[model samples]
Target: MKIAYFDNNATTRIDDLVLEAMLPYLKEQYGNASSVQHKLGRQGSHAVEHARIQVAELIHANPKEITFTSGSTEAINTVLRGISKSYRTIGNRILTCGTEHKAVLTTCEQLTKEGMAIDLLKVNGLGEIDLQALEDAIGPETVLVCLMAANNETGVIHPLQEIAEICQRKGVLFFCDATQWIGKLPLNVEETPIDILCLSAHKMHGPKGIGALYIRRKSKPIQIPALISGGKQEHGLRGGTYPVHQIVGLGEAAHQAQQKFEIATLRDYFEAELLKAVEESSIPTKGANRLPNTSNVLIKHVKTAELMTKLPQVAFSSGSACVSGDRDPSHVLKAMGYSAEDAYCSMRFSFSKYTDREEVDSAIQQLKEAVAAIRAHSPIWEMYKDGLI
Candidate 1:
């Protein structure tokens, strides 16, 4: 049986066009991008530069400002660690939201242990940060503000432009982890005052193990020391032999993502139908603006772990894939005022442009049946029906 994939925010299936663009590099054009002494190396270097341009074009950034990394995790580490080290003389504090990805939150925790003051801003129940709280948090001791464009679990979008402006006015650098937002939505660095940004290719239908970090070089260049230093690669920031095929795939994915179709209709339909089918189901982040392809639903008294086991043909996530192995409830939901039980019961279904209506219907039917089956054996559900605690 063909599985119904709805965990796109974790990763997407590599597009055929992206694969086609990468195969040549994997087979015949396997020259090292750094070994530019010979014709083959020159060819590899040229291809790498071309891919840089393609990736930059997707975000309306200058090609020179894009630095390739292993993925968004490395990119995030590069920005957070590099900025913290390079700007220590200027400030010692870093501000970030409570709902940011583990890539950001984990790095910040390390920095805090290393004597850097780290402040986590609280988010409302709707998964939005208060702009006034953010602005007030920036002081002379603050060097950087780390925020994500979209929450990986709930898909709630942050006010990026406004946040960037606040950081700019306060003379603090803003670094946005756009891993979940880059290819799905249009972002222009020229219009927004974001100082640094990172995205992974696998989240955008490209091959895994490739990503890019964008640093502003236009007005006043955002300067930071190298995170992984050895040889002169990625502007001496991240040094390693470039994966030409993966870079090529990332470029093609960015190119194709420019024309990706709007998928909100299918997602909305899925949520509406599921809510109608499952009793007492609720959308946790319904009030906030979310990604067009993401729906995070909460079913009271129905544990997602139990429901997931009943529907083996379906693919979804209880939270971000990075920490899926951990039994703890979703940190994103907990940060948004959800109880641990509610967070554990929530399921995230992220769609893609290729997701069809039939798949949504099938997933909904399977989920409804699975949820009913789980609730039937749930003593909590029995208590809920009997109007008892």
Candidate 2:
């Protein structure tokens, strides 16, 4: 059976063009990017720089300000922990949202162990943080405020520009984990005052194990100590021999994402038809500011775990991949005031450039059938049908 995959938020299928771009690096041009004397080594170094330029251009950042790491998790840890090490003396407070990925939340938790204050700002039902509360949270003691440009689960787009203004006014550094938003939307750091931003290539049709960090080098350059310590790659900040092929793939993915911005229409159409077909279906952030390619739908009287087993033709995610194994209902849905049952029934369906209209149509039919079967099998749904809910 052909699978209509809608799990781009967890990770994406690397584009063929990106894979082609990395072939030369993997075979003939294989050389340590750190080596300087040999011709192949110099070529590898030059290729790494070119990839840096490509990734930087995608986010409207300078090439010098971009640094490569394994992925967003490492990049996030590098900034959050590095800041705590360097600027902890200045201020020991870190602020972030409750809906952030485990990378930001867990790192902040680690910081709290070291006597740093970690504050989690609550989000409304629409999964939006209160701007006034954000301002109030930023005080003299706040060293950095970490927030994602887009939520991974709910697909809600946070107001990074306004948040940046607040942090700027309060002299607190703002670090954004833009993993879910980078390839799907336009993120112009030049226009926004985001001090630091993190993104992964795998989220954007790039290879896994490769990502970039955008550090502002303007009037007030946000500096931090190195997190990894070994070789002097990534300007001695990230220490390791660069994976030439993976970096090349990341650059190509960024280039492709910059060219492809029309998939949002397909995603919207998918949600419209799915909701029309399944009366019980509702999108979590339907009217809120959300990513164009994401839809977190809650189908009442159905558990996603049951639906997944039924819809073998559709590939999608119930929630964040990192926490899916924990078998817990989505923290994002729970934060939005969903009951435990509602949260368990909610599922995330993210689209990509490869998701065509026909696939979406087929997937909608499959979903309607699967949800109906699951609800029919559900005793609670039967109870509700008899007015006992």
Top TM-score model: 1
Stretches off by above 4 angstroms in model 1 are: 218-220
Clashing pairs in 1: none
lDDT accuracy of residue 211 in candidate 2: 95
lDDT of 1 at 272: 90
What local distance difference test score does each model get? 0.91, 0.89
- 1-389: candidate 2 lDDT, tens digit per residue: 68999999999998999999999998999988888699899889999999999999999999999999999999999998889988977988899988999888888888889999998999889999999999998888889999999999988999888999998898888899999999888889889989999999999999999999989997766778788888778778988888999999999899888885687788889888988999778998998999988999999878888889999889998899888877889988988888999999999999988888888999999988888877777799889888999
The per-prediction CA RMSD against the true structure, in angstroms, equals: 1.0, 1.2
